[model samples]
Each structure stands twice: as structure tokens, then as C-alpha cells.
Target: MSQFTTPPPLIEDDIVQLSYPAEHILQIKMNRPKAFNAMNNALNAALEDVLNWFESEPTLWVAVLGSTNAKAWCAGMDLKQVNLGAKTMWTRNGFGGMTQRFTRKPLIGAIRGYVLGGGSEMVMNLDISVAGEGATFGFPEVKRGVVILAGGLERLVKLVGHQRACELALTGRNISPQEAKSLGMINYVVPDDQVDAKALEIAKTIASNSPDSVMATLYGIRITDEAGSARSAHRLFVDSAPIKQVHSGENTIIGVRAFAEKKQPKWVASKL
Candidate 1:
């Protein structure tokens, strides 16, 4: 069994609270509820630092990201903290330390209420999203005389395609969670109180799998999304070191022997 460990002192920031909801599952609660969980400089930095640690932590396999309250997942960038044309508003990772971050591990979003501008941008980048029935999604940057420059414009198009993205992004119209789900932005929609639970449920399922396989699967998805075609991505996956590592790793042998023995397999901490 995997034992929970203490988070490093750097992740002790109030803006980002880290906890283990289950073995191999990291739960990140954005704690700026007073400001509707807006992504200011401090929150962005805290999230980036914690996520950096999460990615490198051998015992951790998946993460569930949510806010402290259900009234709003996030209200987007804080105008009070960031002025127009200012590059300092962004961390090395784009909006919310997530929109532009190239993450290897899977991240599940627990979302509700108004998620606008950069908030929705972060949604597009999540591996899976579970939202409340009343959750709202929008890119309202255009209404503020700004544009979705924090990787939202391109990602939005990829998520829902050109016409649907333009319709919602151009008019700055908000859509219900159901509509977002139909458009492939959300995976599950439940009551507001159930959002976090559903996300955790998904996270634990992923956590139960061999970490090596999970990382390799995500890597394949990343390659497919970036490559020109299925054929190209398939070829890359066949020749990739990640695939080779999974084939030659100890977990593979453990899995095979466990199946033959008719018993549960104890996954080794992934060295990938």
C-alpha cells in the first residue's frame, strides 16, 4: 500500500492547498474563494510550484483541481494585479499555471459556477472535467477589449472546432455545463455538491492503474494531438522510449504474473 506523505514547505502557500484524497491522487484546492478564486500573481506562482512537484513525485499518479467554493471556479485574470500589455501577469506556465503548461500526468477538473476568460482556457487543457449542473463556461476577453492570448484561442478551436468556438468566444456568451458537455468540454455534470466527489472518483480510478501505463497513455495522446495524422502518431508511439520503457519495466512483468496467479498486482512506483 502507498502511504501518504507530507507536502514540501513550498506547497504550504494559502492560495493553493494540497492534500491526498486517495493513494497516488493529489487534490489541489484553490483557496482564494474571497476573490472567486481569481488567478493573480501569487496564486499562479503557487499553483506552478505545487504542480511542478506533483509531476516529479514518484508516488503520485493523478491530480484533482478545484476551488474552495462552488460559487465560482474562477473569475479569470485579476485586472487589479495585471495591467494591459504587461507580460508579468503570466507565469512560465500560461493562465492559471495550466493553460500553457505541458503536463505529463493526468489532471481532472472539478468545476462549478462561472468559469470565464482564462478560467475556461484552463478547462480546455484539462484531461477530464466534471462540472455542476449550473456551471457556466465562457471566454469573455473580447468584451474587455482584450483577446484570449493565454493559449485559449487556439485551444478553444481544437476543443470545439472553429464555428462553435467563434460563436461562444466571439459573442462572449456563456454556456451551461450541459452544453459544454455536449461540445466535448465536460465529461460529467452533477449537482453542485457532487462536483468534487465525481472528480475524485475519476481520479482514484486513474490512480488505481499502473502509473507507467497512465503516463505512457497521456504521452500517446499528446503525440497524437500534435502530429499531423493518426498514422504519424501511431508510428511515433511504436518507436517512442516511453512505450519501450513500459514494455521493459518491472510493472509489466508484475502485471503478467499477477494475472496468471489470480491476484491483485502491486504496482511499482513509476521511474518513467
Candidate 2:
């Protein structure tokens, strides 16, 4: 059987915490219930560290990101911390300071309460999202005389549609978890008590798969999303040496055979 290992710690204090089990799943908890886990410099830096750890750790295959309390996932950027004059395009950390970090591994968001402004963008970056029944989501930057410069508007448009996204961005409205699910913003909406459990369950399920295939699948999906032309997308994947190696490796062979035989694929985890 393939054994699992834990990733390096990413927390600096009560602001952030990271814990990993022997199932290739990294769980990152935001610890700032006092402020509704507001997005500030300290929290941003902590998130960046966690993302960096995920990118560098080869053993990990999946991540679950959530908040410490059930009242708020994140209340968005701290207005006190926002300096309008310091605006820059696609800053080092795209949205919350962890935006620039890249990883082939997937990020799953477990949202319980309000995921607003900056918080909304953070959740949108994840490949999958699971929210609690009372979860609330919004991008009220427009109400503050500021705009959604963190890629929230654009991403929201892609997530739903231009019309629906425009309504929220223009009106600065908050949508309930059920509405978010209907708009395709979340995958599952469970009871508040089941949020973390469901998120971990999904993460472990993904981690149990062949890591090589998982990475390739993620790469393909992201590349396809960015590709403007079909030819370009095809060339990008075809020229990827890592993808080629994994496709021809024993893991793929076993994964394929397992599927055909209706059995679990016996595989080993390899370093990136």
C-alpha cells in the first residue's frame, strides 16, 4: 500500500493554521474569528505561505481551505488596509497575496458563513467549493467607492454568466448558499455542521487517486481554460514533458487497468 506523509507547517500564529494527515490531504484553517477572519496584511501573508507550501510539497495532492468559525468564511479585504494609491495590476499575490502562487494540485473551499469581497475572490480561485446552508456570498467593493480589482468580477462572470455577474457587481448584493449553488458557484451545500466533513471527504477521495494523473488532469483543464485557440491548447499539452512521462508511466497503466477491472489502482506517489 502507498503510505502518506504530512506537508510542512504553514501557520505563523492564531491567524493561520495548517494540518495534514497521512492521506495526502492538506487542510488549511484561517484563524481570525475575532474579526470575522478579515483579509489583512497578516492574514494575506499567512495564506501566501500556505499556498507556497502547497506548491513546493510534492507529496500532497489536494487541499481544503476553510475558516476557524462558522459565522464567516472571510469578510473580504480590510478597508483600513486598502491604499487606493498603491493599486497595481495583478500584484505579487493576485487577490489576497496568495494569488500568484501556482500549483497543479486542486484547492477545495469549505465555506460556512459570509464570503464577501476579497473572501469571494479567494473562494472563486478554488477548483471546487462546498458551502454550508447559511453561507452568504457577495462582492460589495462597488459600494465602498472601490471596484473589484482582484479578479472577482471577471471570475464571477465566467462562473455564472455576464448578466448574472453584472447584477451582483452592480448592485453589490449578497446571495445565499442556495442561490450560489443554483448559479453554479458551489458544488455542494450541506448543513453547517457538515461543511468541514464534506470538504475533507472530497479531498481524501481525490488524494487517493494517482497523483500523476491528477496533476495532468488539472493542467489540462487550466490550460484549456486559458487557451484562446484549440491548436494552442493541444500544442501546450502535447509539448509538456511531465505530462508525457506520466502518461507512459506505470501509474497510468495501473489506473487504466483498475478502471477496466473495476478495482482500485495500486500505485506509488512520486515527487514532482
Candidate 3:
């Protein structure tokens, strides 16, 4: 691995970076260190483009979210840009386009330093997250005269409950990685040096699983949440069976094997 500032193979400029391989794991990186990698229009557009590709492209099983600069994963939308009258409907697109409903593939957020406002919201949408030990998380939108319309408040509420969400959103305060983990927001808190490695480890784990089954499991979880009526449940049920078969029974077997082996599981998946 290169320095955090070094561009990845697929990166062209300062906006974003991408790389994909046979493992079916795509890494999407925000590359604007100057503005704390703020959510600018160009970054949003690039993210949207990559997200669309990730969803439509075949054999893609998982995505890992990251930032180039170690100092800040993202400081949220460029408040200066917003203050300067820049157009910003893309904020609705979510951090690096994770909020796009059509792009329902699983994502793992690999966070390092500061993750605030839109950055915070972006992680909220990911299926799992790994934050660096020095990473800090917050909504902080209130301090900037913006509403948490990009799903930060909603997701924060879901993760930590209403009162805690209000406390963070209302104060725009920062929370350490340990606190975030305690609140159940991040899956793991690794050292700064290990952030990307841990994230890729998880992403590889996800990619190793049967792609069809992983997609279905993700779909099933989403459908369960959206199942507001019997009709919706029925539809989900109808759509879910094919997916279950694609899910490798190896996932279960690995769990049992790990327990018996008295060691951490090294999970693997193959194409269905």
C-alpha cells in the first residue's frame, strides 16, 4: 500500500479514486484534501458516476469507502462552497453516492480522521464501518447553519436513539472512535495505520461470499425494513428464495469451524 495521499490505480484527479478486481470488491475514495475533502459538486458527481457503475456492473459484490488524506475522511459539504452560493442538490446523493436507492449493493466505510456532517451520514448508510483509532465522528451540521437532510440525523437516530442523536445533531459536537463504537455506529476501531487494511479485510471477506447470495441477503435486510404491509412482505418473500440458495452454506460452516478451531475465521466465497 502507498501513502494515504498517493493516488490509487483508477484515480485520475483530485476528486475521487477507484479500483476493482476479480474479488468483486470495489474501493471508492474521496480525494480532496485541500478542502478537507469536502463534499463539492465535482466529488458528488464523480461519486454518483462510480456508484451507478458499481450497481450496474456485473460481479461486483462489495464496496469499501475511503478517503485519500489521513487528516480527514471528509469534513462534510464544503460549507464555504455552500456559503458562496454553489449549487448542491448532490448532497442528497449521500457521501460518495451511498444514499442512491438504486445502488443497493453492500458497502463498508473505511474511515480515518475527521468524519463530520455529510461524511457522518455517508457512513450511516454503509452496511458496515471500520474507523481508525484517531478518527472522530459527528453530525456538526447545526453549527454550520444546515439541516441534517442528507440522512445523518435519521441514521444517527437509528444507531444511537433519538436523544443521543439530538445531542450530537443539536450541538454539532465530535465523538471519538471508541465512543462511536460504544454507540454501535462503527463495527470496529482500528489503529490509524490499520484502517484501510481492516476495511479491505472486511471487504474481501464480503467479496469472497457468493455474490448472488450476498446481494439477496442485503436485499432481504432492506426489504424487511421496507415491508410496511402484507403485500410488501409477500413480494419480498417471493423475491428472496432464489437469493438464499446462492448464499454459501460455507458462511455458516465457517462459523462452526472457527469455534472448533479456537481461532478467528478466515472466510472465503466463490461465484455462484
Using lDDT, rank the candidates from best to worst: 1, 2, 3
| Candidate with better lDDT, 2 vs 3 | 2
Cα deviation of 232, candidate 2, in Å: 3.2
lDDT of 2 by residue, 63-86 (tens): 889988889989987765566543
User: Among all windows of ten consecutive residues in candidate 3, which has the lowest summed lDDT?
Assistant: 1-10
**Deviation from native of the Cα of residue 164 in model 2, angstroms:** 1.1
lDDT tens per residue, model 1, 1-272: 26535354474458888788788888898888888887888888888888878888888899999998778998888876666554555788788889887778999999988799889999988889999998889988889998898887887798899999889988998889999999988899999999999999999888878889999999999889779999999999889998999999999998899999998889988878
Provide backbone clash counts, one per model: 0, 0, 1
List CA RMSD, all candidates: 1.9, 3.1, 6.1
Q: Against the unseen true structure, what C-alpha lDDT does each candidate score?
A: 0.86, 0.79, 0.75
For TM-score, candidate 1 versus 2, the one ahead is 1
> Could you tell me how far off, in angstroms, the CA of residue 157 lies in candidate 3 after the best superposition?
1.2
* Residue lDDT tens for model 3, 1-272: 21222222343474887776336678888889878788878788788777766766655668888988999998888888878998776744665576535346777888999998888888877788999999988887777777888765666787899898878788888999999999998899989999889988888777765556566667767676557876786687565654555544565667678889997765544233
Q: Using alpha carbons, what is the TM-score of model 1?
A: 0.94
Once model 1 is optimally superposed onto the true structure by TM-score, how far is the C-alpha of residue 88 displaced, in angstroms? Answer: 3.0
**For every model shown, what is its TM-score relative to the native structure?**
0.94, 0.88, 0.80
* Cand. 3 Cα-lDDT: 0.75
